[model samples]
Every structure is written in C-alpha cells, then in structure tokens.
Target: MKRLLPLLAVFAPAPAFAHAFLKSAEPSVGAVVATPPAQLLLTYTEGLEVPFCTVTVAGPDGAQVQTAKPQPVPGHENELAVPMHITAPGKYVVTWHALSQDTHKTQGSFSFTVSP
Candidate 1:
C-alpha cells in the first residue's frame, strides 16, 4: 500500500498549475451577428494574470480591428474584454494568449462574422 501511494501521488493531476483555457466568448465562436460588436469578451476556465494576457482581433482584410489591449472584466477574475472598432461586414478572427495566475500559459483563436 505504501508503494502504491507513492505511485498514485506521482500520477495525480496538478490542479494548481492548470492553464486558463477559453470557456466562452461574447459574440461566440463562429457566430454570425447582424451588427458589429462594440467589444469582445472572453471567459476562461481559470483566473488570468491580466497584464500577461493579450487578445487581438483582425478583420477579414487582415488588418487589426481591436482598438485597445485586453482588460479584465470588473469583478470577474477569469474574464477579459477587448474594445473593438469594426464596421465592415466580414469575418473577424480573435486570437488570445493567457497567463494564468499560477503562471501556466495557453493560447487559441476563433472567428465570428458580421453580416451586412
């Protein structure tokens, strides 16, 4: 039993060092909205280090559309928002990199559309 206990401990999950994975978004992944969104909101599976995280939005033409850097949502430690200035009707790609409070890093990208 003692030998097995050590082995189990070695294989146990490390919840304290988990990455901050994307849990949801405002416009949502692959959503089609009639109007452009004023901002992009992202929720993560864990709290983020706001200063070490970044979210970027690019228009269909490949130009950057986000007006500013990502900021943490008030009172929400696991959420971040990016102000947007998009007008054209097309697909927009949002990419994000997160550094969790425990120092684990994660990143991913998704796209949404603005219909004319």
Candidate 2:
C-alpha cells in the first residue's frame, strides 16, 4: 500500500501549462513588405486575458505611433488585432504583452520593414 501510494503520487497527471505565447504574426517577424500593414495581427497559443493585454507600435526613430486599443479578433479570443500606421519607408517595431486566461503573462517584440 505504501509503495502504491508513492508510485501513484509520482506518476499522477500534472497540470497543463497554458501560457500565452506568440504563435504567429502578420507582417511576419523581420519581413520587408512593399505596403505597410493596416493592422498588426498576433495569434497566441492560448486564449488571452483581454483586459490585461497590450500592443504598441514604434517607428524607426523609436517614436510611438498612434494606435487603437488592442481588441480580440472576431470569433477568435486567441488572436488580437491592433491598428497601426507607418507613413514612410522605415522599420517598425512592435512590442506586445499578453496575459492568458491561465493568468500567465508573456511579452515579446519584433520588427518589420517597409520598402519604398
């Protein structure tokens, strides 16, 4: 019985980790696009805690770009769409922070270039 108890405890199913991680992004990481994307699209590995998530866009000179608040993509709680603007040819950096429904938080940054 003692052996069984210890064995059961050791082999018990573990809780699954549900951290929100960037799965993929539009304008793709380090991509050079002929046209600037109207919005930044981010897909995450888990459903997000919308109120706790944020996305920011910055221009080549590290100036903040005016952007609308991030919102859940229609029919997709795991995706957030953030409106952005890039008026001239330059590199843009996007930084995002997400809090998953599991309460885990994750943040990351990536850059993309706009060509003339």
Candidate 3:
C-alpha cells in the first residue's frame, strides 16, 4: 500500500499538464464562405496566455496578410481574435501557436476559402 500511494501521488497532477487545443474558429476549419470574413477568431480548449500566443494569416498569394495582433476576446480568456483585411478570393491559411495559462504550448494550422 505504501508503494501504491507514492505512485498515485506522481500521477495525480497529470491533468495539469494538459495542452490547449483548438476548439473552434470563426470561419472554421475548411469552411467556404461567400464573403470575406472581417476577422479570425480562434477558441481553445483551455485558457491562453495572449501575450505569449500568436496567430498568422496568409493570403491567397502566399503573402502574410496585414492583421492586428491577436487579442483575447473580451470576457473570454480561451478565445482569441485578430482583425484582418482580405480582398482576394482564394484559400487563406491560418496558423497559430498557443501558450496555455498553465504554460503548455501547442500549435496548428488550417485553411479556409473565400469565394467572394
């Protein structure tokens, strides 16, 4: 029983190491929209450290599109948003790096099309 108790203590904090993952997005992954979205919003499974996170948008031509730095959505620590200007109609790739409040880091990318 003494050995079992020590083992349990070591695993008890495993959940605290959980990494944040993309929960959803505004234009959503693989979405085809008729009009260009004015902003990109990303939601994560856990609260993020906005100052240590980043989100980037690549335009249809593969150039980095101009966008405001990602900001935490007001009143929502797990949600981040960036205002973007998109004029062309094509696929845009969004890549993000997230640092969770607990300090775990994660990253992912997805593309969406603007048909307008």
> Best-fitting candidate, measured by lDDT?
1
What is the total number of backbone clashes in candidate 2? Answer: 0
Write one digit per residue (lDDT tens) for candidate 1, span 36-107: 999999999999999999889999999999998998888999999999999799999999999999899999
TM-score of each: 0.86, 0.84, 0.85
Per-candidate count of clashing residue pairs (backbone under 3 Å) = 0, 0, 0
Off by over 4 Å in 3: 1-13
Q: Model 2, 88: alpha-carbon shift in Å? A: 1.1
Candidate 3 C-alpha lDDT tens digits along 1-116? 77799888887866754688999998999999998989999999999999899889998889876477898788999999888899999999999999998899999999999996
* Candidates ranked by lDDT: 1, 3, 2
Which of candidates 1 and 2 is the stronger one according to lDDT?
1
lDDT of 2: 0.88
Output the worst ten-in-a-row residue range by lDDT, candidate 3: 10-19
For candidate 2, the per-residue lDDT at 72 reads 80
Model 1 C-alpha lDDT versus the unseen true structure: 0.94
